[model samples]
Target: MNKIERIGVYTSGGDAPGMNAAIRAVVRTALYNGIKVTGIYRGYEGMIEGDFKEMVSRSVSSILQKGGTILKSARCAEFRTPEGRQKAYDQVKAAGIDALVAIGGDGTFTGAELFSKEFDIPVMCIPGTIDNDLYGSDYTLGFDTANNTVIDAIDKIKDTAASHNRLFFVEVMGRDSGCIALNAGVAGGAEALMLPEKDTAIEELIDSLEEARERNKTSMIVIVAEGDKNGGAYNVAKRVKEKFDFYDTKVSILGHLQRGGSPSSFDRVLATRMGYFAVNELIRGNRSATVGIRGSQIVSTSLEEALRGKELKLDEELLKIAQVMNI
Candidate 1:
């Protein structure tokens, strides 16, 4: 699609909706190409600890639309250390893996790169996290599902906000990236959006709310990224309450909810296409690259390039749209 037989697949970091579908895609694609695939449980922790099982045609028969990762996932703090990562390298050689596919977020890519360099084993990093924060790509695999999840949650919360004539501070996952906050803010019709790129000033928010209220906007909802300087939406809500007599603001952090749910149409299709391509790339003897969605195509970038810090920059154009829409 050539040399990736007995490939080992692992999902590291947090679990997400499309991970299982991705796993299915890889396993099916590899098998169709006459290669064997093994699923590693609990990420690098499992790999270092040697917890792997052969993944067969039936192993992922019904997982294409599943919410969580079939292989499971975990943060391997141990694997980050040189000794722990070395152990993982030893395990890879011990397993006879010609190439490895790691599915997870940024930390997972860094770990895969370290192991790839140490063992001289080709490791492919697949973007499978809901955070959508990975550099070098416009979108991560689980982002569409996560964004839809946020929109659904916001729509539900907005009803309550308007009914009670209160302000809403909805926190979304972004950590250091703020992609989720920014996207969901625009999609959910948030009155104000706060991301990690800019300072979360209380005075500015208070002023905005004051103006909206005076203009007969009885209810307002604001979106905040988790890593915003003023803290999560809960903390921002508390600040608003302290600054004004209206203590009716409520905070809702979508949290892991966005990470679960059936993979959306976009995610399932993207995962399937990428899954097929990952195996094909490995067959072509490509390695140490993280495949990403660039525009409308699937492209490969060396892990070294993907790792060189693609800082998340908010679309200032979207900011202008948000302002124009007054959301």
Candidate 2:
């Protein structure tokens, strides 16, 4: 493989906290290895449009604690087309970017996998989504921060819930995976949780709430994942009210609120470690792979293996704990 002279780094898909930390790590790690760094704005769109900026060490200064990516992120439909990818490759060649560090979730990795294989360019990916659904890693870049944000919202909502003797159905992001909902629900001491990975019937949910009420629980909180089989929080709240109306019902859809926040220290450190590993892996002549942590050790998985359609099973133990604790 040709020596990696310069690396292009970009973030794509939904914005996540600690993405800036990943970018900083990539830029600084590349510079540390005597390699040039180019920041690609707007992900694949920037690559196609030639929106490139030379990044020095100071370019990422004071951004470690910042939420969202300094490099920014966007969905690029054009990147899916061969013609558009060719244009991106032409621009990449013109800019002398020999390798790439792609920071995003599955979509980002898909693009990188295709781009690298077609053009024979080295690429590395960092799992940067808050969903934490990726198969290869125990934790993604912004999962911790997103959970923290949800828990904070849940705690505040609980305060009002108790005061008004209300039942709150708090909806959190997790269209495909229920990691955020499960983690935050357990941490926030919710009365019940509806997860995407599990089929929760409305009647069953009502039964749990009925039990809570029987136990003389004043305030009730039901954490709902957006992709729950029984619809979202609003619909679930409506269904529950029809059957059981002992308490005032409120629906709090914490839509994008879970997506924005200062990343927790855990996320910052995780992003930093993943970012640093991605750059060094590219320099080590790995053509296409993803960096992730497994049991506290940084590791690389081939892009194909990482992106393969493996079922990301939910933590069964955690699920059981959440269920048992609800009583």
* Stretches of model 2 off by over 4 angstroms after superposition: none
How many pairs of residues collide in each model?
A: 1, 0
| Structural similarity to truth (TM-score) of each candidate | 0.96, 0.99
Shift in Å, residue 267, candidate 2: 1.0
Cα RMSD of all models vs. native, in order, equals 1.7, 0.8
lDDT of model 2 at position 151: 91
* Per-residue lDDT over 64-147 for candidate 2, one digit per residue giving the tens place of the 0 to 100 score: 999988888889999999999999999999999999999999999999999999999999999999999887889998999999
- For model 1 the TM-score comes to 0.96
lDDT of 1: 0.85
